[model samples]
Target chain A: MESFVDVFLFGKCYSVPDNLTIMGAMEYAGYQLVRGCGCRNGFCGACATIYRIRGDRELKVCLACQTKVENNMYVATLPFFPLIKEGFELEKVSPDVSVMMQLYPEIYACVGCNACTKSCTQGLNVMQYIAYAQRGDFAKCAEESFDCVMCGVCSSRTSGCRRSGTESSRICSPRSCRSPWRN
Target chain B: MYTGEILESMKKVEAARDANLALEPRRMTAEEKDALLSAYHPDYKESEFETLKIGVSRGDKVPHELAALLQGKPRIGAGDADLTKIDYDTDVLIIGGGGAGSSAAIEADNNGARCMIVTKLRIGDANTMMAEGGIQAADKPNDSPAVHYLDAFGGGHFAAKPELLYKLVNEAPDAIQWLNRLGVEFDKAPDGTMITTHGGGTSRKRMHAARDYTGAEIMRTLRDEVLNRGIPVIDYTAAVELILDENGRCAGAVLMNMETRELRVARAKTVILATGGAGRLHYQGFPTSNHYGATADGLILGYRAGAKLLYADTLQYHPTGAAYPDQIYGALVTEKVRSLGAKLVNAKGEVFMHPLETRDVSAASIIRECGDRGNGVKTPDGVGVWLDTPMIERIGGEGTILSRIPAMHRMFAKYGIDIRVEPILVYPTLHYQNGGLDITPDGMTAVENLYAAGEVVGGIHGRNRLMGNSLLDVIVFGRNAGRCASEKAKSVEPGALTLSHIDAFLKERGDAGIEGDTVSPKLLPVYTHGNPDVPKKPF
Candidate 1:
């Protein structure tokens, strides 16, 4: 009889048969997995994850796709973040910014086309920056949004506003002197 | 050499320089400074000084015969042959360090032959590393070598040589076992048996992979093994020509060190050319997954040495490469997605592929769809349809899919389209070549004492290749060539090769001069050849 292994993923634990790969284990646990583009060969550092055993005490950093599942092994997928500090400078480059926008536009999209600029409690250039960003001019957008106070008046009155009610309640009023753009 | 005309031309250049210097001290505004810089920049030509320099250079070196030669007139005695002496001696010399060469080196070492691998780049940088699918082998109980051979024959339209294909399929299992022993962590089933997956033009699940990075893993393992065996890998070394002995046998080869640009010679009992293929020649087919060094250098070398070159035109175009950001548009997307249940669909979400169609046919369908606009698909240049995204998501979740294929997800994400929610534009790119130096079943080329394997040799693939068979071919024929060459080398008499032949050859080819340019009229045809059908498109 083959030994079985238990692995946890997505807040759930499941038993995987012996000799099954981590990718196979993920499938057994009802998660679909695939190799990403760009040197899907571990060289690209994509698909990297955090893995640990529940009770046994060995810390190992391994590629999820490359590692085989062990009995009672616990694996967690970690978000990709480059280790080099200078690598963040890529954010300032236009091509890099454009690529990031293409990959995760949710982080950059501010679709509430601002009638909010007119209602700004601090009179910031919120509308202009949003317009620049919509046109894919991130530099211009960053420049224009340098002074937004994030008051709720724009959220309540703007027709394009689609943010959640909880988010609107946390908006910084002018009296607070704190910018909501800090995040 | 003492012509008055040369002296006058030199004087004219000196006068022009004087005039330019005399005008440099005038008070100039920013506009004037920009103009001056632009005019005198190193790239600037047609300036007075530049014109004079060109005139002087032309006047001093104008050969009347050269002008006629440039106008399609052949010069007499231009075919001067020079024999060069070989320097290094090895039992086996393997040209190209891709899958085939590395495998051959390992096998040769195992057979007790001193081997040296000469590659155009680092061993793993060839198109083999870009291969996304798995290596095909008859590993499952239901699968057999005969079935694998039949699939290959059918896929190539029976154009493949039956004998060579039989050897490939029969020997493939041992090759896979060798890879496993070398630490290639292939995808496994619950029983620990290697997981076999499907690919284009295959009836059975015969493909073994590590997710989509099958090639990279194989190359990495092979490279590690080659290094561990202490095989000398000469990277950045390109073989320029094969050196034939007095009896028309392949003695060795002349190589050009690409970095230092110096020439070196190797004399071996056997020569193996595993130099991969040529994909850059195609104009408008598909983006190439080939390395920059894959320029058919081995083919040219073999052809010049009188070895038969076959199937020079049958290039394989892989479907589904990214279409944006032109630098990487032609990179290969592993075909495992289809095996994992992803389907090819057009813009209207209709299944465009028969799911099991051959790769060539599938690529053609996608190209036609993009041309006709029948599907919402359009190649960036009306060349092919976009790969559907919803299908990928429907088969696998966005996060799950992204996690498995982080490279593809990140690439698409860079284009501002989440693959989970939006379709990705794709087109076929030149992925592989099915034809090259003609070789025997044992990987020996037509030239005596010469051998080849993997993508460098033709006939195994014929008109088309079966999915997963490429890696199999590399190991199977690679080992065969190595073992055969080692046996042959043991019996061959050691002969003397003098340096005089190489010196004469270099002189006839025009030695690299200190100041004078070395030009070759024979290179024009080779450099000008490219796929005429591909249209010029801006990145």
Candidate 2:
């Protein structure tokens, strides 16, 4: 009669058992892993978590090997962050929208703070793909920020998207796009 | 970074991709970059040519080589790893966690030793996180390190390995200032300098990139400075076999756990084998950008623990991958889009070869322009060429091909094709594995304290591999196999790891008679389910 679930992970509340998977509730809370785990399958975005549930003021984002562990969740993962890297010279920029408005001038400090599309747990629309990459419509900002698993949790609850999940890999340039055998 | 004295002090400098003499729409002549450096040389298929010309691809290993042809499989057997219950005991175990086992567990925990890093997956998933363009370093200002060591052992045909190509051309600009003191934001130049470009066989513009995910920003900044210097990793796990000690050295590794198919024994007095290479043994059928734990499992557990695997059948394909959508098929498209000028064309758009030549002559000019000068472009899994990529956003502007090939503008905008406005299709996949585990530029191998780094060590890029010389042979041999295996793990003394060297390497592959079926090329047969083509779903 399996059913348990407390969670609160890196903050200790454990319990686990039911519906597991926050990498099986952090190895059922003993946390043997030396670093945040990876490729637990949902395809190498290397985990990417960020949660909060206790009463849900809403701050989620998925992939701790594909979601699950919930009741009062709280989680935290991110794998690797502190992103914002600029490094210029695409021939002095010009693909429109002032090239992400002069290398992330915080994309015009958008105040429409939908707190990064209400903390996108893959519902995307992270402020409509930063307003479709500020209207240059980079092919619908590469088709609605292509399932953004940047996991900087909508650039840490964006107020204007400075870290935009580590500068959305500098206006996103996708990879591991699938195929080459692997169902 | 171009040299020949900076391409004779420049002239038509339209810039941003420099090893000078601008690419196509014509300008090359340094004797046409010395006649596109003698292009073309990929001949196999005589039933993969006597298993790659007399085994281990012509370096000759014979006796059940290619990692002792995967010794007696069915694991956890012989004493199901109780070896006095080691469950990990370290001084330096480190085995393949990409970007040379996370820079040899941060240079063996900064040389005081105690390192760990185990990995098969997670820990910046390997293929050095799909190394997108940039990581060759002669460190600009008319570059040196002897012209990046005469353009890396004169682009491989020189059959490299001279002191591991003089310690990867004298420690690649101090491993690019130690990956810019471990932050890896690379590109630089609004008066800050650094930015050097140009790839394939090169003579200068010493690569150095970060813009296009340069190996996912140096394998996520060396897996985040080896997990912020706490350095302990075991990760999903994999080591399969390698225990050695009774004087053959290597002492640790048996590990396993690829998701609880449990098994253990990690004793280490310094092992290292940085696992990489075997391009998932897809070998000559192609399609592979590697990284689903590029299964060689440390080259057949470091050749059943005798180690010395040079040129294990030359591989390196990457002359631009992505054979077409299906998720993003075979990945990679970053030789910084032909050193930033883009132009490989074919399907009648013309322009054959000389797209900066040199990845086995631009992958043997797209396998001789799609076999026998027919001029490629057939594609339903073969024959192609046409990288033009909207002429680097019409000559570097309009977000210059999404800011200098932003991971090929997010892998051709995941099939919707916006590689900064069209033109993508490519070929040559398989990318890097030039052959492995045969170290010694102080990265050991040949047994003793094991050691190996990056593409799982081999004759440092010899049967072709120049495009940014494998992220500068993974941080100058992962800081010389972590400071020479932490000064040989301080004169090692911790012994005891035996299965009598896997029963004398299975009685020396059963007295050199050699047979098959011990598997562990990670137990063969894995088309995995992206299986034999089905993908089409761009979402």
Instruction: Give Cα-based local distance difference scores for all models.
Output: 0.57, 0.64
Q: Is the docking of candidate 2 incorrect, acceptable, medium or high quality?
A: incorrect
Instruction: Supply candidate 2's per-residue lDDT for B209.
Output: 78
Tens digit of lDDT per residue, candidate 1, span B227-290? 6567899876767667766666787777766556567778888888887766644323344666
Question: lDDT at A171 for candidate 1?
Answer: 28
State the displacement of the C-alpha of residue B263, model 1, in Å, after optimal TM-score superposition. 0.8
Per-residue C-alpha lDDT of model 2 across residues A1-183, encoded as one tens digit per residue: 567878887677867665556776676554544344443333346667777787767556666755667677878776665445443332244457666665565655666646666655445576776776766656565445444445555555332344444433233212111000110
Q: Candidate 2's residue-wise lDDT over B271-345, tens digit each?
A: 887767666556656767776456576767776666757766677777778666433456667778877777776
Best by TM-score: 1
The true-versus-predicted C-alpha distance at residue B215 of model 1, in Å, is 0.7
**How accurate locally is residue B235 in candidate 2, as Cα lDDT from 0 to 100?**
70
Error of 2 at B215 (Å): 5.2
Error of 2 at B405 (Å): 20
